[model samples]
Target: MVGASIANFTEIRGYIKGRAVLGKSATEIFKDVVDIYGKGWMSYRTVCRWAKKFASGRVSIENDTKTGRKVSISTKLAEARIQELLLEDARYTVRELAKLTGVSSSTVHFILKKQLKVRKITARWIPHLLTVEQKRSRVQCARKILKMAQKIEKNNFPDLVMGDETWIYFENYEPHRKISNKVWATKAAKRPCIAKRTMSVRKMLYAIFFTARGLAIQVPVPKGRGITGKFYRDVVLKKLDKYFGKIQPKSGMRHIKLLHDNAPVHKAAIVTDFLSGKHVTVLQHPPYSPDLSRCDFFLFPRLKKILAGRKYSKRPSVGSAIYQCLISIPTKDYIRAFQMWLKRLKI
Candidate 1:
C-alpha cells in the first residue's frame, strides 16, 4: 500500500507550480521547465502537470519551499487549477493528484473539488420514474425483506453456501472472426443439424454447485433443460452423494448452507427431501436474482475465462477442463464475489 517516491520531486515541482501560477498552459510550462531544468531533473509531462495543478489550486501556496527555489502563487492560480482538473479528468482522485503534482492529498481534494466548485462524487441514485404506488410498494418490500434477510444473513449462520448451475460454452475457444459482405467460399458457418445426436452433442451440459470452500462434482447433464424429479434424483443427486453421504450429518459439522433459485427442479419435493435429509438448509434466492447466485455470477465466469482458448481436443477433454477450472479460480475472487452478493441483499 505504501512505497517511496519514484522520483526526487521537490525542486522540479516548485518550478512547475511557479510557471503554472504565471498563467501558462501545460505545453508552455513543459517548454519552460525543460529549458530551465534541462531534462536532467524532470520530464516535460511531469513538470507541465505540476504547473497545471498549481494553476488550478491543487498545489497550494503553502507548498512553496523557501530554501533553494520558491514558486509564486496567486488567487488566479487556485481557480485555474480547479477549472483545469474538472475540464480535464473530473474522475481524477485526490490521491492521484497528490502523486502527480507532489502535493498533499487533502490539498488537492480541497482545492480541486471542494473549494473550486467541482462536482461531488456520489452514487447519483436517480428515481426509477415509476408510478407512485408502484414505487412506494417497491421501497416498502425492499425494506421489509432486507430487514428479515439481514437478521438471518448476519446472525442465523455464518456458514452459508448459495448454489446455482451455469452453462459453459466451447465457442470461447474459437478465434475472433469476421464476415465479409463481398463473397465467401462456402457457408461452413451453417447451423448444426437437428438430426445429429439429439441436440446434445454440440456442447455437453455440466451442473456446478459451488461455494467459498469448493464445489461438488460437476457432470454431464444428459437432459439439461428437462431435469425432472427422476432425472434430478438419479443423475444430479447421485453425483453429490458426498454432500450427504458420510460428510458429517450434524449441524456445525461443516459450513453447510445450500442456496438455490426458484427453479421447479430445485424446488421439487424429491430434491427438497434429498437436501433436508442431509441437514443442508436451503437459502431461497429472490426470483430473477441469478445475479445473486454465486455460481452464476462468479465461478462460471472464472471457469469460462480459464477455458477461454482451450478446446475439447485436449487430453483430459472438456469435462476435465471444467473441473480443474472450477477449482483453479482464485479463492479471493470468489470471496469478493460473495461480498458483492451480500451487498445486493439490500437492493
Candidate 2:
C-alpha cells in the first residue's frame, strides 16, 4: 500500500511537469489537478511552486534536504536548569526561560510541559489575607454556626434572615465582560468597540435583608449619608422590623435570627441594643469572612448580575431595577442559598 501511494504521488508530480512543459499556466494546472484528485490532495500554492520549478528545467520532484542545525536541546541538563529557574521565580515567561537556559523557546516549552509537567495560573483572589489567628477564628466560628444550624428546627429555618449592604452603581459593566459584551462578527469585519469607562461614581448604598422564603426588604441609605450605627438603627432596622410585622403580625420578631457581617456599624452599641430589645438573635459572624454570608455569596451576586451592563439615568431607576430583580428570584433559590450557607459552614 505504501509503495502504491508513493507511485501515485510521483505520477501526480509527473503530470504537473508535463503540464508545465506544455506551457499551461499554474492556475490551469492546479484546476486540472483538483478536478482529478479533489481539494485536499494538494494546495494551489504547492501546485504553483512545483510548476515554477518544473518550468525552470528542474528534474527532481522530491523536497530538497537543505537545512541548518537541528534542534536537540531538550536534554536532562536543560530540563533541570528550567526547573531551577521556575523554582527561583515561577512568574518567568517562556521566552525569558529560553534566554536564560540558552535554548529555543519551543525547546523550553517542551521541557516545562512534557518533562517538568508544570503550568502557570493566575493568583486566586480572596476577601482578605488572613493571619494564623484569623484563620483559627474562622474555623471556630464555622463550627459554632454549624452547631447552631443543627440545633434549629427545620420548619423554623425561615426565621433566619441574612442581611448585607452593597453599593449599586447606576451604570456599570458586567462582571463577565468576555461573555456578556461579545458579539458575532466575520474575520474580515472590523471588531466592534465599546467605550472604556470606569465604574460610575453615581451610586446608591442599599441594605438587603432576606430569609429562606425570599427577599424581605431592601433599604436604600439616604443620599449623602454613610452607613453609620445611627443610620442602621434608625432606618435599616426600623424598615426591617416593619417588614417582619407586616409578614407575621401575630408573631412579630419572635424566633428571628439575624445574620450580618462584622461591619463596625453592625457591631455598634446602638445596633446591638436595638436587636436585643426586639428579641432578634444576631448570629455570630467571623470578621473578613464574606464566604459565610448568605447575601455576599448568593443574594448580592445574583442582584448584581442582573443589574450589570444596564444603564440607569437616576438613582430611583437603579433602585427600581434592583427591587424588580430581587423579587424575581424564586423562593426555592433562597432556600438553596441558605442550604449552601449551612453546607459551607461544614466545610
Best by lDDT: 2
lDDT of 2 by residue, 96-141 (tens): 9989988889888878887788889998987579899988998998
The number of the candidate with the highest TM-score is: 2
Query: What local distance difference test score does each model get?
Result: 0.61, 0.85
Q: What TM-score against the true fold does each predicted structure earn?
A: 0.47, 0.70
Report the Cα lDDT for candidate 1.
0.61
What lDDT tens digits, residue by residue, belong to model 1 across residues 1-347?
12223333565576677767778788887777677656766666666657767877876533545564333473346446656765787777767766656667766665665457566577565434457775565456446545555554554334555555566554455322223123444677655332222334356566776555565567566634655777776777665655544444554313366676788888889888776776665665555445557676677766776776665643237777787777776766656666676676556
Candidate 2: 10-residue stretch with minimal lDDT: 67-76
- Residue 114 in model 2: lDDT: 78
lDDT of 2 at 216: 88
Error of 1 at 22 (Å): 24
RMSD of 2: 9.0
